[model samples]
Target chain A: MDEFELIKKITPSSLSHREVEIGIGDDAAVYESKAGYEEIVCVDTMVDGVHFLSSHSSPGDIGYKALAVNISDIAAMGGYPKFYLVSLAIPSGWNESAIETMYEEMNKLAKLYKMDLIGGDTVSTNGPLVITVTVIGEIEKGKVCLRSHAQPGDVVFVTGELGSSSAGLALLLEKISTKDEGLAQYLIERHKRPKPQIEAGLICSHYERVALNDISDGLANELNEIAVASRVSIDIYQNMIPKHAELHKLHTEWEKFVLFGGEDFELVGTISSQDWERFAQECADHQVSVTQIGQVSQESDIKVFLLSGQNRVPLEKKGYQHFK
Target chain B: MDEFELIKKITPSSLSHREVEIGIGDDAAVYESKAGYEEIVCVDTMVDGVHFLSSHSSPGDIGYKALAVNISDIAAMGGYPKFYLVSLAIPSGWNESAIETMYEEMNKLAKLYKMDLIGGDTVSTNGPLVITVTVIGEIEKGKVCLRSHAQPGDVVFVTGELGSSSAGLALLLEKISTKDEGLAQYLIERHKRPKPQIEAGLICSHYERVALNDISDGLANELNEIAVASRVSIDIYQNMIPKHAELHKLHTEWEKFVLFGGEDFELVGTISSQDWERFAQECADHQVSVTQIGQVSQESDIKVFLLSGQNRVPLEKKGYQHFK
Candidate 1:
């Protein structure tokens, strides 16, 4: 099929949001802004071999993950994802059905958030397939969560378990083995389809002075960013970092994955001690796991620290860094 | 350099616009929405070896054109360019300095429009380099031009000359030889840096019920889109279509380039006959060439027609379809 036909086949017949004045099949998408909301914009690109292995990932999984990662950014900002545009550079070997399946998977996730697929571009590429998704979201004028908002007395918390995605990736790449089929499948799911913590982010936005960062580049790198941006020191208890219960069964060094492996898509942030009780309760009511992992301190000499029993060691900012 | 350091190096110290509350270094960029404006969004991706040859075009040219194409989409909607995000997938062979030059070139263009560079992703890819730009612009509420707003009695108009970009590309590829060095250089610049018709678009927006479309996909294809969308027939006088004065001096079928060539990045649309005189006067004052190339007709049987003397031929939609 040609580009226009493929677009027509993939575009959803109806848009979910009234804010979208013009969807696909336009020179540009038009969105009428609301009176009291601020817009959040972010773009993320995933390449065939760099971001995902096409051999291991289904087309649906690839598409879902591409859009999910952008949504996670919106969640990190304590915003609601309302619209998205996807630009795909398809390799010649791929079939039309694969492209359609990708959009279908993306639409499935977008429907859950009431987000509209506004506009995008599709072109043939001679190299690996590249998918870039740009998401436009909104939050109340003064409610955006930023990394620089962390305060000295705030308690750092993380939503959901970390390192499972890395374990899942390791298993998929055959770098590690797990005897339990159920655990292996669960970890693989975690790697391929990460659920963005939008509900937990919304709960954080209700409270004042919450600084947020999505853990895409591992816990160490993300925490260091928060500390450096806020100009505060952070200390994390080794025992308090949340891990999947079945992750210990794997043969890999699970601690390394938790500390430095990336693509968790979980929100890590700091909140005032006074708001932690109410925030934790709200998250619990929504069935979202919330754990207090660290604390922000006034000391600026050490940007990040790991506290293991008695010894306190400075944490190195190590994660996925491109062009290293 | 790592991703973080590279981002820090490229990010502007001060944003050009106050609406951009949070720029790079965050999960997402935040923008304050204005009360009387509607947002216009568009995305375009350029892949190495497909869109342009690395040997022929500089990194600066590729970067500028990548963002320029997106800005053209915004211009087609008669919107004022505001902010943009760029996602780049760099191949292993590319150096940090080349990437910096790319951003610097893009920033120069952004400065011309007072547009701010917000947030985007940079990742290492094993395949060809890819650049995807998403532009966010705004227009007065209810003033956005569209392809579907053409009327039966409207006069068809196009801004600037056509066919120069295609001629330039041919010269770059050595498909056609040109002895005139000045004309060759001019055509090459036209192909590498086709300025978007933002001023012409803003002028069109000031008038009521103007149908606008960008000529990225050739005159025939773009006019056919307007005809189909507006459910009207269009006729273009072959002799009236504007061309560069020096374009005919080259040994090539220049008419084919004007009609079927893509990436000219000029504006083509329909305007009411009653408003054409004032619109033409305004465009002349701004030094934007507005030519009346054709007219819209009430007949819906034929979508688009090209008239030459007494003969009329149906214009085929034959401009740049991927995966043919």
Candidate 2:
């Protein structure tokens, strides 16, 4: 399909919002910010073979995951996603039906997040398929969370279990067959559609002296980022990490996945030691389990320890880094 | 270079603005909008071998053009460019120094436009090089321009010359050895660095009845877009198109380049008949020449007539379409 035809076929006739002055048909999308709120913006790109393989991911899943990653960025900052612009670079060989399915899935996710799909460009590419999404969000003034706000004595907490997505990816890559179909499906789905911890971030943002960020580049890397940005150190106990039971049963070194595997999209944050109890109670009310995994320190070194009967053994591994 | 190290090297240490609450090295960038102003957002992508070939275009040119195209979108809406996020997908074999040069060129453009280089993603791609830029701008309430605001009897005008970039691309691809060194460099530069018509757009936006859009596609295509969106027809004299003099001298059928060529990033706008003289005077004062090219008509069909001895011949061709 041509650019205009594809846009006309996919563009929604109605994406009603009070702040939207102009929508998809304009040169640029225009919207007003509500009073007393600041805007938070984030962008992410997903490539065909590098980010996902079509053999493993459906068009729907690919579209959903592309938008989901940006949603995770906004969720990491404790903001409400308001609008997004998507630029698709489609290769010539791609089918129009698959393109339609992709937009359908993208629209479904936008509706779920209450976000309007604004304006963007769709161009033909000579290489692999690439989708880039720019998400615009809003948060109350001074309420947006930051990675550099972790205090020296803050208690580091992580929402949800870690390493499941990485474990799921392993299962997909190894082509492992399991008798437990349910377990296999669950793990694969974890890799396919990881949920962004928006509620947990929102709850954490309300508390004083809180630092928040999502675990997109693995747990250790995110913690190190928080440590480096906040100018503090972090110490975590290996036993404190919440790993999936199925993952542990399958792999002996599941902790490696938990610590170094990325794309979990789970929120790892730091709250002041004095406010930990109150934050935990609020998190419980929100149905988000909070686990204390580490503590912020005055020294600027990130250290992970395995607690033996009497002594602590240092477990050294940095988080996953792209282009390494 | 690793992603973090590259980001660290490229990111500006100090990008302080009153509206920018948080800048780079964050989960999401945050900024506050000025009261009574709305936000305008646009995104565009450039892919290797599709948008440009590295053999012909330098890394700096590719980076500058990538950001410049998005700037043109903001300029089309008459908005003040404030910030942009860039996502780079670098293939495995690319040089690190070239990547650094790309970022440096991008930074130079951002500085020139008074925009901040905010947070974005850098991932390794197994395919070709890709760069996606998302820009955010601000305009006063109800001051943003739209393509659908054209009215019947409005005068259609375009800023600067048309088809130079397309003509430039033709020369670059053919490797035509021209002894006129100045002419060759001028056309090549036109393709490499398109200046967004920000000042002209801002001046035109002050008028009460204005409809504006950038001519990224050819004049014929953009006029057709305005016609379709505003539900009005447009008619122009074939001789009125502002083709580059050198191009006209080089190709006997140079009108085709001016009519159907893309990538000319000039502004094509409509102003009511009564406001035409005033707009023209203001444009002249700003050192921008405005040429009256066409008029919006009551009928909903676009037509360009070449006056041949008082006999008008119709020009057939719907302009360039990506898939076609």
- TM-scores for candidates 1 onward, in order: 0.98, 0.95
Please provide, for model 2 over A1-324, each residue's C-alpha lDDT reduced to its tens digit, 9 standing for 90 to 100: 667788888878887577898888878999999989999999999888878887788988898889888999998898888898888888888898998898898888888778888987787787889999898999899898888889778898999999888777878887444667788788888888988777887887787667888888788778777776787777777778887777777777777789888888999989999999999999999899889987886765555444535766554447554323
| Residue range with the least summed lDDT across 10 consecutive positions in model 2 chain A | A315-324
User: Which structure among the candidates has the greatest lDDT?
Assistant: 1
Best by DockQ: 1
CAPRI grade, predicted model 2: high
Poorly placed runs, candidate 1 (over 4 Å): A321-324, B321-324
Tell me the interface RMSD of every candidate, in Å. Answer: 0.6, 0.9
Encode model 1's per-residue lDDT on B22-93: one tens digit a residue.
999899999997888999999999998888778889999999999999999999999999999999999989
Instruction: Tell me model 2's lDDT, rounded to 2 decimals.
Output: 0.83
Clashes of 2: 0
Residues A1-324 of candidate 1 have per-residue lDDT tens digits of 588898888887888887788889889999898888999999999999888989999999999999999999999999999999999999999999999999999999999999899899998788899999999999999999999999888999999999999889989988899788999999999999999989888888888899999989899999999988898999999999999987777864779888887898999999999999989999999999999998998786648999998988989898864213
lDDT of 2 at A130: 91
